[model samples]
Target chain A: MFNPPTELLPTATNQSGTRTAAVPSVGGRTGIARILLSRDTVMIYALVAFVIYAALFIPRFASPVSTGFLLLDVIPALLIALPMTLVIITGEIDLSVASIAGLTSALMGVLWGAGLDIGPVLIISLIAGVLAGAFNGLLVAVLGLPSLAVTIGTLALFRGLALVVIGDNAVANFPPALTSFFTSKIGGTGIPTVMIGVILVAIIFGVVLHLTPFGRGLFALGYSKEAAIFVGIKVVRAKFWLYVASGSVSALAGIYWTLRYSSARSDNASGLELTVIAAVLLGGVSIFGGKGAIPGAIAGVLLIGTINFTLRLGRISDVVLIIVTGTLLIASVVAPSIFEGVTKWLHARRHRRTLPQASASGATRATASGVQERK
Target chain B: MTLDTSPPATSETTTRRANGFAAVLRLREIPVTLALIALVTLTYMANPLFLSQQGVKDLLLNATIVIILSVGQAMVIVTRNVDLSIGSILGIVAFSTGTLFVTFPGIPIVLVFLAGMALGALLGSINGCLVTVAKVPSLVITLGTLYIYRGLNNAWAGGTQYFAGDRPDSFGALSVDTIAGFPVITLIAIVVVIIVAIFMASTRPGRDLYAIGSDPEAAKLFGIPVTRRVLLAFLSNGVLAGLAGVLYASRFNSVGATTGTGLEFDIIAAAVVGGVAIFGGSGTVIGAAIGALLLTTITSALTAIRVDKFWQQAIVGLLILAAIVIDRIARIRTAKKLRLSEARDV
Candidate 1:
């Protein structure tokens, strides 16, 4: 009875926003529905448009070789985003993913430097990542600390531990075969072998998020924790394991990053969280949670990658790149609501023009500010 | 999780007693002060020079900028917002201050500071305007600004760095000049802290800030000027960060694009460690200042004892976690106690 209602609940009764009718079951969207009028259709079309534009304008940009390199550049962020989408979908964020990747990379370096074999090093690093995620989960899901506060601390803690394990030193002497395999292209193709890992992970994440009961449960949980609880969803356990999954994926990404770069450094992938979050949010994943798809996030990732590539080709300064990213991130957040508002205004205008008397005008206009006023 | 900031039942003797003790524990910086003393004592036992006059000055000098920034940062956080762009602001102001000295060799010392503060307030106002108008979470807005400002700093620097020799020695001496063995800059930080502390403690707007943080909807219903206050908080934080930037130029004797890169996290760590609740509605500038001192001292002590520098960051991280966990535990106990009291009344 003392429990405050704002947290982990269906917010339908409590806030000023359009409430989505809860998806009733594990029935994933069919192709036609998925492609048409979905929230992320904008991102999907933009990605396609960007690809088309780049193909026509930029030299060799449409080639498979450029795609391979682009994927490699974005691989670390893309890998982390797979799980991040789930976490964000569940109404939580994992800011420590980059730090976990760094820590895993550091662990690999320190262990390898001590002459440990690569196999054990990889295993241990992945385990450490899972443990880190578990710790965050325990705090947030069980102890019920705010994830924002908890993850901010853990971000530092994980990064600090990475520094402690390998202080300011870069280990670049990973076994040549591993580095070669990590960076190597497929036979006579522009595709990198790393695509295998990414594709495999993406397929798994896609199926799990869209086609499975657990995936439906994630959506339910995000839409409303209290509702999910009432529906017998294990809210705490789902949140706990989501973090664990995030951690493990990050660790795998770290191993990939270490091999891909042929170096292990404490600061590897620093500031990566922002880019991944930008991608996720850009993909039409609601920052407010419970509405997103992996395909959209992928498209978002590719759009950012294409933009980065085209800008680089234009010889734009790296500083300009960061500014573009910041701008795009901000625009992605603000533009959607503005679009909704304009459409609503237009609809209202059309309605007013058609009808002489506007009955129920108050009810129609009451939701005008709802999109902007989340609180 | 509810983030409801309704006050406890004051009529119950048990609740009142518990609250009084908790307030005393929280209001006084006793825990942090005691921790600082213990850490220093232990470190001194290992290395006496750490407590030596020069060592003490070094600690104070290192902590001054962080302390000033923490005071400002605490205010922003207390209002359920954060300014991640602070480090960037510091970098910009520091570099700008250095450029001012180079550009106008005859410029008065105070004018440089004023110029830097004006630049900072302008940046802060931009942040304020975007946050208030857009209604985006401060995290997203400031995160965007963090990179934007840093990018601006980088673009401005364009691989150039300003050295101490570029400035008048009088400007450099501002950091070193001692008043009764205390650095002038440190004194300035203390004064800023005291003033902000007083303002937060005694002013209506200041109290309103806590109310807004605790439960913003209620604060709005109560007719608190949420937008203006939040805007002011960001602006004020910007001003302090600018002050810190000016000090950074003096103390570090060099200004570069990377002057304050990644320091926002460190400042946040200091505030969280010092017991400023990240979720808002609690903590003090004094506690935050002491937190800055403690964190800086820990670094100095660890360096003095020849421990790994990485441990310092980890320890700060741990302190952040500890503070949150302690807060969680306290909330749980208070909740249980409140429930028990309700049961007894029934």
Candidate 2:
């Protein structure tokens, strides 16, 4: 119903039936118009509107300590989402990230409980996380299996291994040395140390995704793997490393979760894969791949976190919170098509209106003069 | 992103080769069956009690819910979609069914089953409408509904649990009453499996599902009512999950908010292991049922042999990886053959 505007994408496909059209670039003629019409622009407006409304309406919504907790609460999802954005950008996904996070938490608890020194224990868990990610890379990249199915399998497998290590037992009372730094606020600014970590990761991921050759390869792959290959991109290697990156970052998030909470359990961050995904999509990352930004995703994550914090503060039932999340997830995805449809309909209405005028003015004059004044 | 090796040709075109159908059959479920047998044999040899009557009952009982859920899941997967909300649906229906039993205290057990299924169908239809009409991927839509439905369950049944003690003996006995040697619940699961398998293999719409899953654009071009077929697959899956919910109340004797939480993973694992490709097309519901059986038995065997129960999950993870790898190899070979044939024609 909403075919992309053909004029902007002529020769978008070649003889091999590959999609050669890139995401609409925000440069050159009518660049300002393109920016105004894009999803990211819409998201920025929504994020600002939401923050202002929440601050005014909700008691203490804009307070410093609350902001710190909000940032801390969203760190794992925020961190994992960076790599997830890349994974999705390449038109693939890593469903095993949350499970890997949970596994890391379980491992951290078990290794520490086994009386291993905390330093070595932490290192081992992180390595296990990397290996787990590499295994996914092997299947999806090297072996060419569907990431969804393979990750679903690993999702269960990793979660189960978590239970194997911890069973129903939970480990609390972690050492101050391990938990203190990540949890402590930075220079009395009410910003948790983890916020700094997230900001650093976001900066690195943002640069890699938007500026580097590897980044273009990712966008190209999302456009079409065959086209990317034809263009001489190392399609397989790029995808593999992204998956591994997703895994390691997810594990790092797991470590943060355990230390911040000062408790580790097999089910740490259970069902959180959905939350991370929702945040990514809400951030305006196209679920179909390609067409998204880390900054937009960051805003999306903050919006959801702010909503949750507000709901909790208002003492709204958890049920309401869940419904709001689902509604937002559905709306975020469904809204874009509806937005495109409306624009198309409006364009058609104007086209018909202008057609009559063109007939009156003579076609050549209408085409050149009338349109020339539009911009 | 699934870059399927085999060309998305019509089934007839693909299966016309002398060894094609045979290759498919060999690849689909034989490996899972062999693995089940081998694990059983090895586990039984180590602990004879594994094959003992009590052990057998535990294994069958543990597997029945997942088997039922997997059959439903395979249908959705064949449509290149998934229903993550089924677990939450089961939890909701199971709790409601438990409430029904307690409130009425004299309702027919059959009626309760119907009520539970209808409730599940209603929830499932929401997923269908969203995926079909919204055109959002089922994974995203269902993931959303998974939490929404679970949230509803929590809100409705907060801290309230229904125990078998509250139900009549006749109701709970339904799970245990045996026909020949099989548990009544297990018999029901087998019947459902057989019926679904037959329908999928024999019906026109069933074949249409395969066509749609194989290639959506091709199926649409063939005039297959793609949207309707996909909706039907989702609706049926919901009904089956609902049925699983009723059985959960019957067997487990306790229904609560957590009754079927996180169960979608196990169901999906079974379906995948049984050889259902997640990208849609290929594989059977019966294979999924067997996959459920194998996974449950693996869990049983690991526990029986005194291995860490944790390792059981890891092995299943390994099995899932192996199954996909094997399927991928077969696909590559088939794709190569097809390519060669296409070259000959050119």
Candidate 3:
């Protein structure tokens, strides 16, 4: 039942060094039009359309003040989402990202309160994150444990450690200069100065994911681990490093969150994993892995941020925002499959009409339709 | 279906296979049970009052709600699917139970339970339908529903909480009254575990669940109704969660939007630690029940021994990781053993 050529053909590398063959050409169309209609492009279009709509219809939405708050709000999600896009592309998840951030925040608060200078405190907090990531990588990558279960464990473990570190306490006496710098805008753009750092992180993840041989290997790993190994991808090492990167980025988000809010607490960023995941999924990333883009994920983060900000501006409750997010997540994954099913059914019906004699035998009709459906 | 027609070698292998399966089942419960006993004994040694009648009651009561939830969760997990919205389902149902008592003022307890369970079934079927028809992973679907249901609960409960005082004394007594040294709610959980365990062990449909979970494609090829079985699992899970919710309303001081928030993780952790495989297919409700008991006991034991309460969660996390690692090791050993045995036969 296994077709050797069908399995082998896609793994063949082309001259451009991109695994472009892995992406199926839609509707027999090639090149620019196909790229334009892809899921990532569609997500970008939706983000643009939603932004325009919010600007036109919502009051006070077009101002730079709105931009400042929206971008600030989405920064943590945008940061974590960079590595999350890669993780999901490789068919695993790290639910502990938010908890790692919480742990980092708690560590920062405790270290700062214990009379440590801010510079060393920041570095130690990030190292703590890297260690947490390594622990996860050790379990999931090295030991071959399921990432979901392992991360769920670490999710509680890290948060629990955070609670132990800062028990029901909030540290708010951060240096005023650093805090102000965190919220400071560049010139008259109303964007936070911290955004530059976030952008650099995003770019690094994007370049690694989309421009490197290692990133191509990640896609192959997601599609089929055995095949990835066959093609000489160091699947285990790549996954291990991806998790480390995720932890480091999550820690950075933690530092930014603490300074931007000027508070460090154990509960910092609790429940944020959901929002990060929802945004990533809405960005055209397949949860089953092997498909996604960083730009689309950034757009996803911003689109959600804009919607929430506009709703907040309109005096709408957070409840509605939650509902909107959940609905969007479900629709994003469900819509494509439903569209494909409809197309298949329509194609089968048309074929039946054209070849009336084909429907004479039930078995023959089923086989004919199935074969056409594959095409 | 008759094994007598098979050759002697085949029959011998089948018998050996049966023995191995039985051994694994028995082995799954041993470690958790041993751990639970060890924790209790150590707590007792630290503080004799830990085993006092009141302390014992408290431990059972603490575990009752979790035990009920974990049993339900084990059923869904056994089907190779998960229902992350159980916490939200419990929240909504608990709130509804509270509201029912507050509004009706004199409603029968049975009617309230029915209403809560019916609501849960409705919600669960929505999840089941979406998951089955969508062909999407249960994780994503349930995660979406988790947010939507929690959002709805927030909208509905909006700072309104019904306390234990709002319910009738009889309803409150469900957690208070002890029958043969067991709280009524704990007894209810025990009965649920027993009944569900029997259903799982003896029923054809129950066996089909294990098949579907172990390998969904193979199960489908073998003519198992994967969609229907999976939907049933979710429905039953919802009903049990609803039952837990009503019990929550009775035992806890208040029921509101945030009543069951974050409980899903604890329940999942319990199921996993109890030896219900996280990826599904080979765990029993009984083990999960013991796992729930073990976790709740750990919290009480820590408090009794004067360990910092903050360390409880960390310990639980470690326990989960340890359990998964152990399960993996055991599975590998079994695979190796089976390979060696098959090689000898060849």
Candidate 4:
């Protein structure tokens, strides 16, 4: 029999785990780098590239007025996406955001129509949003229904409630002060107060998601629910907070929407959840959860907004834009899978060349025996 | 293999709990069925004309399209997927069939039916490819397609509608004809349900669907062709939705891009109310059929009572909530049983 060295033992067992880790990192990071120049640095570069492209290609695309319009238009999506990003990172999703936004708008409309003061209307709207969120949290966190399914039902439920509340009526003419505060730019410089609100929310959530204990716990929950529970994270409470946050933010978006449009129709923002989700996915957040960032989501919104604006400026038909959005959603999902497949294929080839020759070695022979037994 | 190999005490307790819990949850549907029957009875009592054979036929006819759509929706939902684009698919197929009839006025209605189903299957395959090959979540993919399909239909059928006068009398007869005091359309829907029920319950592919839905990764590890099966599920769902579209065209005798707007959610609601878990795995085709009947009956009941159309949406919402509640209760019980068994194993 051939003598084998003891030092080679670690390479035979624990080395496989390290090998697996290294393979993914190389493929994910290095491969991403070669394609886009750098994995972590690409988002910033892309954003910059977009701004430059817009400025060069589209007239007035870099103007303050255009910037303001983009910011104002995308603010509601950003506000809602901040909390949605968190919930998704925690391995759950909130399909009811669009519905919640609709319901809140309807409630605001009803309350305003009923002659409630601004303070009371706002409070009621927020309360309504919170209660709806709590209902979702209870269903998923307490009763343990899958979030996707629960939210799908509630998507209908909440939107239906909105319809019942407003009943096809459009509510316009909010108090002048409210509109001024929410919709007006800073001294005609094109930066709206609502945009300011979005920025603040983004900065705060960015810090919380990347720096805080709760944020890490949320990620841990996403990575492995059982492990998170074992590690003493209040997984249920985290989920509850996530839902509440999602709801509150969605309600805020609704209020801003009312301010901007000065109208609250039940169908207002109907199917908006699709765009919100597409943005999140495009931002590089895994649909399976446990991996993503607010910055990425913001980047996604910018990318999508830029794409839409560019297409419009180019006078592309709305039909083509819709197709492009669909294509983007498809691309985001497929890219990672293709990347993974290629890496796996390469890694398998490498292993076959390097390890198969030593297949009859003691431990290798044992694994082969195990495979045979399993068969 | 049948006996859970958990700790004996916990396993026994878990088995007992699982049995009892399933029994209670299963019986919950009885109330909805009873309520449906009672409503029908009350309507009959309130207006004897409601019990007339003609009225029964009318009710069944109105419900047939939705019932067919719900069956397809249930199959898709069973795999933890949703097809919101079905409404658009239905619109596209219905209008296309109408246009085909208008263009080829010489063709038999049967050929038109096949053509509509084939087109639907083609659209569904698109959805399946986007989902399986692209690895995108079905919700986003279907949502995008919902708009695309609707937009295409609108563009193609813009400023136009196909009416009863545009189609042959025999084509219209599919919806209007009666057999044994029942509309042929409803009978066709019933036949569709029976075929779907068998496919879901008895076949190997059908059972594999439950496995995939229950745990996709686990199923894949166990050597299930996860992507292929999911793709097929979506394709089958698409085809059925398309078939519903064809029937819809024949039933309504008027087709346009707006033909099936918003029907997707309604069909999904029926599936959920039928006790099919939206997350996939456990559910019954029969339950979906009952759900369809319940929803359709409610609409007729509302119409019979002369309630406003607005109340219809609200009532549908209430039913969806009720179904979700039932689903939650069942899930909790199942989790509890699993936990108990796990405890025993420990």
Q: Which candidate's lDDT is highest?
A: 3
Which regions in candidate 2 have their CA more than 4 angstroms from the true location? A1-29, A114-118, A165-169, A348-375, B1-27, B339-346
lDDT of 4 by residue, B253-300 (tens): 689858898777778888888888887887877787788888888777
Estimate, for each residue in B216-255, the C-alpha lDDT of model 3 and write its tens digit. 7666656777788889998988999999999999999899
Q: How far off is residue B328 in model 3, in Å?
A: 0.5
- Reference-based lDDT, residue B292, model 4: 80
lDDT: worst 10-residue window of model 1 chain A: A1-10
Q: lDDT values of the candidates?
A: 0.82, 0.82, 0.86, 0.77
Cα lDDT for residue A344, candidate 3? 50
Give the residue spans of candidate 4 off by over 4 A: A1-20, A26-48, A187-189, A351-375, B1-32, B38-58, B134-136, B154-165, B215-227, B257-259, B303-311, B331-346
**In what order do the candidates fall by TM-score, top score first?**
3, 1, 2, 4
Score candidate 3 by TM-score against the native: 0.93
- True-vs-predicted CA distance for residue A79, candidate 3, Å: 0.7
DockQ (CA atoms), all models: 0.44, 0.37, 0.48, 0.28
What stretches of model 3 exceed 4 Å from their correct place? A1-27, A347-375, B1-26
Better of 1 and 3 by DockQ: 3
For candidate 2, lDDT tens digit of each residue in A1-375? 112111012112221232222112323226677667566667778888988998899998888888788888989888988998889878788888988999999999988898888889889989988988998898899878899889988987888888888988899868997688878888767789778778999999999999998897898788778878999999889988998898899899899999999998999988778788888888888766766888888887788888888898888876677767777888887766455445445544565677655445333333333223222
lDDT of 2: 0.82
Give a tens-digit lDDT track for model 1, residues A166-197.
Answer: 99999999999989999899987778898898
